[model samples]
Target: MKKHNYSAGPSILPQEVLEKAAAAILDFNNSGLSLIEISHRSKDFVAVMEEARSLALELLGLQGKGYQALFLHGGASLEFLMVPYNLMTKAGKAAYLDTGTWASGAIKEAKTFGETVVVASSKAENYTHIPKNYTVPTDADYFHCTSNNTIFGTQMTEFPDLGIPMVCDMSSDIFSRELDFSKFGLIYAGAQKNMGPAGVTLVVLKEDILGKTGRTIPNMLNLQQHIEKESMYNTPPVFATYTSLLTLQWLKNLGGIAEIEKRNNAKAELLYTEIDRNGLFKGTAVVEDRSKMNVTFLLEDESLTEKFDQSWKAADISGLNGHRSVGGYRASIYNAMPIESVQVLVDVMKELERTA
Candidate 1:
């Protein structure tokens, strides 16, 4: 049986990408050295870094001006700190929307550097829905939010368009769906989720937001420093970057982010339909705020959970377990996942229904 991967991060990748990545590990582009062993300072590696950054931005349709994109080292977690460090000033406080684990984590980090106001919190209802109608204070530094709550299976489909600058940690759904690049002053995500393997982080920051902080930021945390170096201030993550480059090439060839978003919508719809239409199952997230990347559901009869696991695993389906916080089952339908894989899981659910 062909096993389908449904794990979240370090998760599914294009089969073709996997094959190419494995082959390159031994001999990169016939350069006669392993991709893992090469110097990140070499011309070949520098070209890899440059192309990856350029193509990633191009894929996002950030072609014109006023915006700069970088693939940095830390995950989005670091971005929570760096964003406030660079964008939030001494007197001004940044506003954040508390949605789930990652959003709260970002809030915690931002507090150490500057005053952070949590404008709204979804934890009131267990993070099943995005908060409705929040206030964005003008005097605040910038508004922050997590685009999608991966663990809770919720998404902010309608972004909070505060008149002030906006920032988001789009880690789980960065390139998975459609977004307006102009609305955000800064954006960051760990590469492990939708983009590539777990090394480089994608950051999109408006050029105007950099120098305003006026406080001394550590060089590594300074977005301007990394941007000025063309993301080569130190040794970059070569293999992960190469994977990201190829992924961008793949996205471009398949059509850009818009086309990919359409597919993502279809995939999420298909899975959610199965969950709703199937007997003995209930969705975890609120209907109004369901996530396209991560779908969490519960079985009507908790006793059958083990059986469901065995049945799916016996069919070679994998990674359906939910996060420890919200337990039941979660199907992480990330970008690389195909419709057919979700169909397999749905079919498995149907078979179980018939058997019961």
Candidate 2:
């Protein structure tokens, strides 16, 4: 049977990119050395580093706009601490919007560094919807938000005009859609989800935003140091960085973010439509705030769970199970997920509806 992957992180990558990465793993650039064994400072790897950074900025329309991209280690989780540690200062507060698990984690980390205020939150209702009509403090150092909630299946469609520096965790939806890159002071994401495999995190920092915090940042956690080194401050994640470069090249060949977004929307609509129209399944997040990347849903009847589960499994669907926190079903349709796979899942749902 054909496999349809819907895993959230460490998820599916483009077939062409995977093939190229695999070949490089064995003999990178025909140098008879694997990408893992090559030295980080080598000229070949240096070129890879430069191209990946340039491609990221170019794809986002941020090139020549004072934005620098860095592919560093330490997942977005660590960034939960680094953002506030380096940006938020004493006698200054940082504002955040709490929408899901990751957003809450970011808030928890920011509190330890400075006076962190949650301007808005949806925790009262189990994070089924995105908070709105909340006021962002202009006097704050920066306003932070998570672009997409993977576990809760909620995403912020329109960002607030905070009138201050804006930071975002775009782990689940970084290159999946187009955004106003200039409005954000910083954007961080774990590359495992949309960009490539696990082991590296992508950080886009506006050079001017640094040095304003007035605190001595650790050498490892400092963004300016990484930017200055061209993402070679340390050895860096060699394999992951190379794979990410391949993926970025694949994206550029496929018309970049604008074209991939159309496909992402079509995939999400196909899955969510079935969940809404079918009697056995219902979507978890609110319609307006539903995530384009992770479409979470639940079975309407507990007794029909086994049958539905078996049906999808038989259709070669993988990672349809939701997060442990929210027990239902989640189909993470990332940038690399093909629409044919989505159509197959939709056909399975229709079959279940008829046979149930």
Q: Tens digits of per-residue lDDT for model 2 on 204-270?
A: 9889888788889998999889888889999999999889989988889999999999899999888
The model with the greatest TM-score is 2
TM-score of each: 0.97, 0.99
* Residue-level lDDT for 193 in candidate 2: 91
**All models: lDDT?**
0.86, 0.92
Query: Model 2: residues >4 Å from true position, as ranges?
Result: none
Candidate 2, TM-score vs. the true structure?
Answer: 0.99
Which model scores highest in lDDT?
A: 2
For model 1, residues 1-356, the per-residue Cα lDDT tens digits are 44798887878888788788899899987999999998988888888887887776777667675777788888788887888999888877999999999999999998987778998998878999999889888899899999988789998888866677899899899887777777888888888888889988989878887788779888888888998998877778788888887777777777878888889988999989989999879999989899999999999998888889899998888888999888988899988899999989998899889886
C-alpha RMSD of candidate 2: 0.9
- For model 1 the local lDDT of residue 1 reads 47
